[model samples]
Target: MNVLITGATGLLGREVFRAFQKNEWNLTGTSFRRKSPGLVRVDLSQPDTIHDFLNAHLPAVIVHTAAERHPDVSLRDPAGTRRLNVEATAAIASWAATHGAFVLYLSTDYVFDGTKPPYRPSDKPNPLNDYGRSKLDGEQELLSRAQKSSVILRVPILYGPCETLAESAVTVLADQMNRLTEPTLAIEDWATRYPTYTPDVAYTILQLVEYHLAHPDFHGIVHWSGNEGMTKYGMARVLAGQMGFPVERLVPNPAPPSGATRPKDAHLDCSALEELGIGRRTPFAEAIQAILHPA
Candidate 1:
């Protein structure tokens, strides 16, 4: 099967590319700037370019992991965010539908309002921020346009060794431990999301593709995330404990309201995914250890 993955140079995209490579799948990956072997430089912001590429490639599956994912960045440039996240996604979904190719769109837990915990796939989305709103737009576009051959997988805060945010957290804690000083603050009151190992998410995507191929009638939104939920402070503690870092380096605090308005709780329930036998939540500790000691 020929599979095309967009945003192949980003953290999650790179992991997905590696997984597909290991499986010896006929894969073509795309990036905007950085070029790698088997990668084509395609700008999602250009619908004509994207459409031409899709028509030429005619891939059996299109795994779209690209988007303006940063919440703050999205707030700063909402127009650009919509261009890439919403409009571009709609274009891709339309192209995929035209070609009769299965499209797996990566979504986020941010689609929830955070007023409720452990969001289900059936739950109505009430996005609190620009990033969430844009993603929700993409989800709706894909669902409404490519109803029969689309899968929307909403993920949480992804944590892995290669992930930029995860690595930043590790580096900050390590620096504090080296200095024998405690980190100033951790957002204890802000209950947010769990983390998904990149490889695990990629595996689940592959399973979704396989399921679609076999059933031929399966298509809809699916929730894929870690087994447990934790606050930012709790996740930090887990990282410290698993890495054998000094736990004293963590200081509990509340999220400041001056910055971006994040959902207080966005944990996703994967019961629908579990029913498919494709969503198995990886343990938080194990995921932490893997990040600490990547092989």
Candidate 2:
């Protein structure tokens, strides 16, 4: 099967590519800024380019992972976010619908207001920021166009092997902790987030793809996330122990994180996918230890 993965150079995309590499399927991972030897450089921002590429590849399945992932970044440029996340997705979905190609769109837990915990796939979304809004719009675009052959997998904040500490919001905490200029660093303790492991999400996607192959009628939205919930402060404390950072210097602020109003807690309910026997969760401490102290 010809499988195309967008944002192949990204943290999650890279892991997804790695997961597929273990299989016999023909995989094409797309890249943009951080182009690699194997990845194809395809600008998802260009509709014509997407059409041309889809025509050439004619992939049996497409794992769409490209998007304006950060909330502050999306807030700074709503137009750009919508163009890439929504408009580009609409174009891909339209093309896939006509061509009979299956699409697996990656979405976020941010779509909810965070007022409710463990949000199901059926829950009505009320995004607090532009990033969430854009992702929700992208999901709507895909579902409307290719409801039968598309899947919207919504997940929480992700953390895994990354090029830099800055690649993930969760890993960036270590960078912040290491380069602290002040006497103490205050981390947000108000908002609770599930720092999902990327490798696990990759595995889940692979299983779902196989499941789809077996059951042609399997489509629509599903959720997968890390089981454990922790605040930035909690994560920072754990990293401090592993990296020998000063836990005393790290302060926990029980106030909402400033910039781009976020949900207090947007824990995604993964039961939808769990019931189908498609889920994985690595212990937070163990995963962080492996990442920080890799042999």
Task: Find the candidate with the highest lDDT and give its number.
Answer: 2
Q: Write the per-residue lDDT of candidate 2 for residues 78-150, one digit (tens) a residue.
A: 9989989999999899999999999999999999999978799999999999999999999999988999999
Number of clashing residue pairs in every model? Answer: 0, 0
Candidate 1 per-residue C-alpha lDDT over 1-295 given as tens digits, one digit per residue, 9 for 90 to 100: 7899999887778878877787767889998877676689888987667788888888989999989888888999999999899998999999888889899999999999888777888999999899999999999999888989998999987755564433433334444444553345443546656767777888888788878989988988889888666666777787677667666657777754444578887888888878768865668787667666766
Q: List the residue pairs that clash in candidate 2.
A: none
State the lDDT at 68 in candidate 2. Answer: 81
**lDDT for each candidate structure:** 0.80, 0.92
Write down the TM-score for model 1: 0.91
